[model samples]
Structure formats: structure tokens, C-alpha cells
Target: MSEEILINSTPNETRVAMVENGMLQEVLIERNRKSSIVGNIYIGRVEKILPGLQAAFVNIGQSRAAFMHVTDVCSQEKLIRLEGQQAATQSDVSLPPISKMIHEGQRIIVQVYKDAIGSKGARVTCKLSIPSRFLVLLPDEPNVQTLSIR
Candidate 1:
């Protein structure tokens, strides 16, 4: 595992330096004033549901609303359960509509999947993905599959 050691002194400033092979490859400095919201978990309230787009605008206590897609809402177990119900294999199937899965005014735990770019809002997902040095952790996945990169 690639372990990260964070050194912090004051509430005003924080620095994150990524060490690889005993050498610093990346350094990030965060001031108390400016920070990115990506990967933040929020207990957001659903603001609006758009069936036409199969997405919802969520309030994650940010300046602009965040966007949550239906496909990103379902858990891995839910996907498997749905796949089992259909005769279609995993490679041949797509998920069902998001409208059937989530409703408006629901308080859901969502993680920021993407940062807000320009006028666009941050992309949020109910399915949380945790990444480490060696592996990308999917919380709902039962089995860990390894892929060989060519």
C-alpha cells in the first residue's frame, strides 16, 4: 500500500507531499481559504429530480448544486441483483433508469466524483470509490478482480 503521511501545524495552512521511491513527486498546499470539494462525502438533500435527464440536482451545501446520475446511485449488489433478474450477461447489459431507483427530497450520502468545471456543477455518486496505491476499492463489490495491464 502507498501510505500517505500528512503533516499539519496550523488551521490556516496544510501541505500534502506524495513520496514515491523516497522522493517527493507531488506537493499540494491547501490554505484554509481555498479547497477542492472533490471526494467529500455529504449528507445532501435532493433538490430536484429530472426524469427526462435521468439525473437529480443535489444540495451538498455548496454554492452551486451537484449532479447525480441514476446509474451512479445503484450499489454493486443492486447491479448484480438486477443482472440476475435478466437473462443478459454483464457484458451485454445496461442498467435500468435512475428515476426508478431514487426520488426527490431524499437525504442520501453522496461523494463528489468530479470537481465543478466552469458553469457545471460537481458530479456526485452514491457509489463511493476509494483508491489506494495498489487498488481501487469498490465498497459494494463482493469479489476483487485483478487486471493485467499490457
Candidate 2:
């Protein structure tokens, strides 16, 4: 696999484009006013916990509370196949209940996985992952490699 990076800088903004195999993949933009916060780690307080949905809402100094699902809270031992690749998707592996994992008003570190859309807040995960130039690394998935060189 091969990749190329294109960066454009101006006085007001800086844009970084990543092209893989001559195809446009991702573009990151940073403006003078606001910077992109996706993939940023934050020490946040757990705002609310919903036992019914097995999820929680956390305040990470964002406009809206980010979401934390049960699967993201607990580490899974079993591995499942995703639509695209054999990455570890959450399975019915009998993980501990969310209530046992965390509580409201508690503080924990979380990472933003998805950006906030329209009226919805961002999606966060306790299991953080930072991508490198040629590798998509998951902390828990040490033995799993999602990409292959052609």
C-alpha cells in the first residue's frame, strides 16, 4: 500500500489532505478560529448514565454531550468480522454491565471517534486509537492488521 499527503497553508486556515493509491481519502482542516478535535483525548466527567440503553453521556468541554456505548466501555475478548474487514467488532461476549463499569458524576478519559453531526453529539470511546501514516492501530487489537500491502 502507498499513500501521499498534501498540505495547504494560508494565513487564516490550514488544510491537510491524505490521498491513498491516487484516491482521495481524508481531508483535515484547521482554521484560525477553531481546530479539529476529533481523536483528541479529554479528561471528562460522566454526565448521565442510562441503564436501559446501556450507554452514557459525557461532558468533554463540547457544546453537546458525547455518547459512550456499553461496548466501548468494556473490553471485548471475542472477535467478530465487520462488513469490510475482520476487525474486532463487539460481540455477545457477556461483558460486565455498564452500571458496574462506570457511574454518573465520575471522571474518566475518553477519545472522540466521530465528529458531531447536525443535532447529534459526537461519539466517544474509552478505548482510544491514534492512526499513523501507514497503519491503523487499535490498542486492544494488537494481533489484528486491517490493511495489506499490494
Candidate 3:
């Protein structure tokens, strides 16, 4: 089944419906004001690096800076390259040292994976995913596997 986004707007509110075939599968209502911030890409500057937490805070021109991890920094190819570079690097692929990967004042492109909840900042990732009706496209990944949909 193919899916499409149908946006309906009123003076007070805007409703977005995800339609599959001829029926509405999901409905998202935004009151002229509020919306979710997930999947937003921003060109951000690294504010601070916390080696203890294995993460970094990035200024994405928001009220709060986004958080990115070292594991999230390297692409799949980069991980493979690192593994091929040295035998010792293979074990560190999953949880790489953040300090060695990123530094303060570095500019990076980050996408919000999760929204800021309470006092915590947005969880960000360098990996970006584009979703389609039938498939999801990961630009950086080389291998493509077909998935069976039921």
C-alpha cells in the first residue's frame, strides 16, 4: 500500500493525515502553534564534549543544545574503515571515545532523533534516515536489503 500526506488547514488549527490507499491511517493535529521537533536537521556547533558521558552538546540555534554521541558520529563506512585500520579499534566501534572523535567549536550536521523531555536536551544523531511509503533510504549505507511487508 502506498501512503501519502494530506494536510488540511483551518484558521485555528492544521491537521495532517497520513493516508494509505483511500483511508486515513493516522491523523496529526497541530493547533496553529505546536508541533513535534523530531527528524529536524540542523547545522550546529559543538558546545562542549563530555568524555565521561561519551556525548557532546551542540548549539542548534534552539533554546537547548542537542546531544550527540561518538558512536553516532561515524557512518557505517567509517566504522568499517576504523575496524580495518586496527585490530584494537574493532572492540571500540560500538562505544567509541567521544573526546577522540569530536571537539568543541566543531561544526556538524545533526538530526534530532528524540525531542527534549523535561530538563534533558534533544537526542541527536549524525545519521539521517528518509522514510518512504515502501522503504527507508539510508544514504550513507552501501548495502541495501529488501524487507518483506505484511
- Work out the TM-score per prediction: 0.68, 0.64, 0.72
- Give the winner by lDDT: 3
Query: Candidate 2, after superposition: displacement of residue 43 in Å?
Result: 1.6
Model 1, residue 4: displacement in angstroms? 12
Give the alpha carbon lDDT tens digit for every residue of 1-150 in model 1: 464655665788888877766766566787887567888889999998898898999999988899998777876466777667563555455666766677788899899979898898899999877776567787777778796533
Better of 1 and 2 by TM-score: 1
For candidate 3, what is the TM-score?
Answer: 0.72
lDDT of 3 by residue, 1-150 (tens): 888999989998989999889887767787765566888888999999988888899999888888887778867466767656543545644645888787899998888999998888898998878776678887777789797755
Candidate 1 accuracy as TM-score? 0.68
Q: Which parts of model 2 have CA positions greater than 4 angstroms off?
A: 1-35, 78-92, 142-147
Writing each residue's lDDT as its tens digit, candidate 2 over 1-150 gives: 899999999999999999989988888888897555789989989999999999999999999999999988745642232223344444544556688889999999899988888888889998878787578767766477677645
Worst 10 residues of 3 by lDDT: 86-95
Best candidate (score: TM-score): 3
For candidate 3, the lDDT comes to: 0.82
State the RMSD for candidate 2: 6.9
Model 2, position 44, has a per-residue lDDT of: 85
Error of 3 at 149 (Å): 3.3
Every candidate's lDDT: 0.79, 0.81, 0.82
lDDT-superior candidate, 1 or 2: 2
Q: What is the lDDT of residue 59 in candidate 3?
A: 94
